[model samples]
Target: MADSTQVFAILAVTLAAFVWGRFRYDLVALAALLASVLLGLVPADAAFLGFGHPAVITVVAVLVLSRGFERSGLVDLIAEQALRVGDRLILQTLVLSGTVLVLSGVMNNVGALALMLPVAIRLAREHDSPPSLLLMPLAFGSLLGGLTTLIGTPPNIIISAYRQDLVGEGFGMFAFFPVGACVALAGLLLIVLAGRYLVPQRAGQASLDAMFDTAHYLVELRVPEGARAVGWSLRDLHQAIEEPVPVLAVVRGEARHPGHTFHGHLRVDDILLVEAGPEEMALLEDKAGLEVGPEPPAEDGDGGGDEAGTVDTEGLQLVEAVVRNDSMMLHRTVGQLRLHNQFGLHLVAVARDGGRLNQRLRDIRFRPGDVLLLQGGEGEIGESLATLGCLPLASRNLSLGQPRMLLVSVAIFAVAVIAMVLDWLPAAVALTGAALASLLAGVLTLREAYQAIDGPVIVLLGAMIPVGQALETSGGAALIADALLALGRDWPVVATLAGLFAIGMLLSNVVNNAAAALLMAPIAASLAEGFGVSPDPFLMAVAVSASSAFLTPIGHQSNTLVMGPGGYRFGDYWKLGLPLSLAVMAVAIPLILIVWPL
Candidate 1:
């Protein structure tokens, strides 16, 4: 009884920390694992064993394989085909969402969504459709597709591993298809048929220029002959302005110099591209004796140039890109990154939370989903974005894997799937082999493969697995199961299943889905034991419910990712998500019973 009480208290604090959103989830999970060990609930020797567990290995391999799929250019091929279907919104939704759905089953769901995001935005721009109508369905489809395959989600993998420890054999690659495919199909139908009318339309960041609206913030200042600011260094000009406006670049005689690197004195007729508002522009003109002028016009084949050829903004182009969750820019200020000195890129502007940021560029720290407007050489910008772990918002053909490597990557993936289905090798071994094969075949480099692994998620799984076992071994799971059973004693056993499923679903919304499964799986096994029924149905219930985190943007990364691009609010999700979640539950319960037999 004391053990159960202690375990409950530890879990309560862990869940609270997860919901607080102050610290990283991996750090929170690690803290819980240490607490369990210090309290003597989990042995010190066993505390680190989860790192080498087969589930953790499989997840890492799957992430690498997902990266291979993304770089193969196969998804690009399919997206190009889907684009030819014309402008009918329903057909576009079906094809776009359906493509992501199928891809998610084979790759990581988040990776699947990442590949389709730009394509969906392109579709919205081409058709003049509100991105709100398409992005949510695509995001939701990725989640539903994860239900169909074991590797589709971390929760399903966790549950399958737990079943292995209990029954001496883990679930096969296709074992989840029976119940998961049915539930996923039902959810997909709901998203396609009703998602259009249900999801609210908003002014999303549908286009590159539309999102930043840089025209409002940018001003061109011309240095006239004998002007007070003439012959002054760019630093002196900025220091004299007395405002926060930044000089982005200086154009002189067809040569555009980045403001940060130009140490020479400003020359007459030089046009300074400054990021400023009305007040700052006024201050610059009044204090610096500079006059505002029209922006440099673009010449054919020259991205941006002046008509008189005095100010030629050549070689510098603005590229809008979003910071990914694993971005090197995250939590780092522009000054820290040394955008100009290190990467030869200038931070012109940033947008977040569906609006442009008003903070000074140097003071603003990057965050996931924050859209950044960067200025650099067009030739090096794509390479810089890849290095920074950012995704460009502009629609362009993917250049990584071309005509020949596509076939190589596809062949490698197909072989791995065949090996898994035939039980020629265990999932972890086969997937690991595939990942190594990808590295050997030049599908991805070793560095690229390493970057593909989500370190935080791996940490969360490795740390939480031992803590979850402590809960079961300490009798905490059985005690909770007993209380739930006593409450539902008068009701049918199916009602108990429903209650367990609901609890897992709600828990997943508040925490990571993988963590939700780790915590709920033990109780599910306990419930099945108490009822004298097979645990297969109960475990299936946990897997499906844990992945149904559709009610809030914070419930899953997919939902949060689409929030800024789709222009959705905190309240907008439940409009479509609530009904879709209910449909999943309604479809999943009956299917679990029939497929696994309670």
Candidate 2:
């Protein structure tokens, strides 16, 4: 009883910290674990054993394999093959959402979403609508798909293992399919047939033509005599700066040929009408000793003689590309890439959500769905794009991924998945083997494999596992179960189940999904004991509700990811999400009772 008080106090402080959001949730969980240990709630010898838990190992391994899937180009291959997906809106939504749903079940749903996001944009282009119209459905579909398998999501994995501890046997890989499969199918159909109508069609992504009264990052600089830029051709000077900044005009005594010119020879005292971000503009002043303020054209020849003949643009061309999920440049800025010095390519302009940027190039972080206007030679730019993992947006076809490696990666992953399903090895062993195989098979590098793991997520699971065990060991779970029983004492058993489901889902939206599952699952077991029924239905309900966080972007990482790319307002989720959450409750309760029995 004293132990219960200590554990309850620690959890309350932990919950408050999470809601405060001053620190990350993982840090909060870790602090709670440490607190529990100090209070003698969790044994010191077993304090760090949560790090070795099967669920943690499986999640880390799954993340590594998800990276392999992304790098292999196979997921992209599927998305590309679905190019002709369908014609009408309903058919298109069905085919696209169904594909994501299936893909989400096998791999990390985020990876699945990343692989398919470009395809969603392409589909929106074909349909002549904003990406918002399609992206929300895709994001929601990815979340729903996670409900159908033990390894499908973190919440499901946690629930399965908790059952394992309770009954001395865990759920099989496909155990969730019996009921969750039905819910997923019904939810997806509603998304296709009815839910889409609620999604607003805001032009939130990749519209480069006159979308707004955008910024004109126009600045001017003058080339000084004896400067490094003097006597060099315009092409040489342009190449010197890399590509984030564009030279709008080369003014020599007002005899400029073209204002938005690509290349020309530089003369001493030449005034450059530069249209570029502040970083590049600063670079021009510092690197080339160019002075501020535009000057009149030079007193020399008109320089209009060559017209299009003098500047050699045969190999060099401007390419427009959109950042993909696997891009190294994701969340990085132009200055970080050193585009001019490293790749001889320059970022001319970047357009996001059909508008220009107001932030300086150095300050603005790159995000997926941004359309970058690049200037460089064909070979150099193409190689750079491949290295950066960006997809060409224009009609030009440039393949940046290695399709040949896809086969090897799939085989490596399949061996592990089969091993797990067939009970040939534990999930952790099989999946850890697959992650190592991915490295040995050359699907991904060791550094990339390490980067693939979400450090915060791993820490959260490790810390929360011990915290949860402490809660159960101290009878806090039973106490909460008694409270829940009191709340529904006069209600029917199914109604009590419904109340638990609502509580779990509401908590999930408020907290992290895995945390919700951990907190609710044991209470659900106690609820089952109180009602004199099997705990399977209650556990299943907890899993379902924990994964049903659809009311807000903050609920799930996937939803938050789509928020920027889809250009959705925070309140936009409920337009479709509210109905979908209701549908889950409407469908999941009956399915759970039928599959597991009350």
Candidate 3:
């Protein structure tokens, strides 16, 4: 009883930490593992072995292969081509969400979602809706797709292993298809029609134009020769104006330094990039002797940009690009890259951590996922960004991607899936081989592959494994199981399955689904034995319930993965998730009863 109490305390604290978000999930999980060991709930020696567990290894491998596939441009090519499907909102939701659903069955759910997310975002913009409208549904689709196959998700794989331990034979690859497919189709239909509306319209740092209010606020002012602004400090110009026009950058002779109202002296031929309206521009021009120069000259399919920053505003255009995880710009300051001198483009602003940066643009280092606002000739900006490994959000073109790398990555992934399904090699071993092949083929760099692994998710999975075993060993799971069974003891067989399913869904929503599954599998088997029925129905109930954790972001990694990109808050999940979970339970219970015959 004391051991059970300690395990419960440990888990309670872990759940609170996961929801708090004050600490990273990985740290919270590691703390739980240490607490379990110190409390003697889990043996010291077995605690760290989860790092090498098949599930952990497979997850990391899946992450690497995901990175490889992303670099290969296979998903991009398909998504680009898929643009022809239709432009209507309903048609787009079906195409993108349906694609994710199918892909999740064939690859890691998070990985499949990763490939589809940007595509969904593009489609959302095309349909004139917020990405929030699409991402949550796509995330849910990934979860539903995982239900259909043994290797589709970790929960299903764990359930299969438990079945084998109990009955000498496990579920085959397609054993889950009947129930899972039914549930998935129903969920997809519901999300297509209703759940999409549940997702809120959140405007975040998805575009640079939005970040700077560029359409109305940005303007260029030049200090022509013999102008009074050439003799006055930029600070003086700021003090003279009634309305504030924030200077974005100063384009000087052959060099552009980030501009500030309090820094540097304006010279003849110097151009100031500022965010202001025509009224504010007239105010600045009247007070500071600045002229609103004509727009820069236009360039045609070439890297020409008005003779190195002196040209009128004809050829220049603003672009928003994201620093990809594999970008060469990672850790390098904009000044170091000499974007103006070397790339012939002006670095107007960068958005980091969902906040706009207007000061110290040059010294600021680039990180993956940083959104950059750039200006130059269209062709030059595209070429320079491609060389820097930056992906332009404004344009979803993949013409610059390597076709050979794409083919090699797909071939390697195919071999890995075949090896896992045929049982020639374990899932971990097969995927590790594929990841290595991806590295050798130059589909992903070693650093990029390492970064691809969601460190917190992997660590959380590793730490939770031992804690889950401790729950069963310490008899805490039995404690909960006995009470729940007592409540449902006299109920009909189907009611018992429903009771177990409800509890599994609730627990999985509060904690990591895999850990929830691991903790409940033994208790589920205990219930099936007491009823003198095949454990298949109960086990299948636990499996589906655990994977159906849609009520919160913490319940599943796929949901968490999209939360930031979709700009969703913690509370936003239940808007769509509650109904979806209810729908799953409605379809799953009858299907389980009919298929397994409790």
- Considering every candidate listed, which one attains the maximal lDDT? 1
Question: After superposing candidate 1, which stretches have Cα over 4 Å from the reference?
Answer: 204-208, 223-248, 258-265, 279-291, 294-316, 325-332, 336-344, 362-367, 377-389
lDDT per residue (tens digit) for residues 306-377 in model 3: 312233332236667666544567678765786655776666667664457655554577755576777766
In candidate 1, what residue range of length 10 has the lowest lDDT sum? 301-310
lDDT comparing candidate 3 with the true structure: 0.74
Better of 1 and 3 by lDDT: 1
Clashes of 1: 0
Poorly placed runs, candidate 3 (over 4 Å): 161-172, 196-212, 216-248, 253-395, 399-407, 441-443, 560-572
Model 2 is weakest, by summed lDDT over 10 consecutive residues, at 306-315
For each candidate, the alpha-carbon lDDT, in order, equals: 0.83, 0.75, 0.74
Question: What lDDT tens digits, residue by residue, belong to model 2 across residues 248-363?
Answer: 45667856533334356677777765555456666776667777653223432223232111222222256666665335676777778876657666666666654656565556
List candidate 2 segments past 4 Å from native.
1-6, 19-22, 204-405
lDDT against true structure, model 2: 0.75
**Residues 289-362, candidate 1, lDDT per residue (tens digit)?**
88876645554223433322223333447777777655678788876787765776777778776677776665
Ranking by lDDT: 1, 2, 3
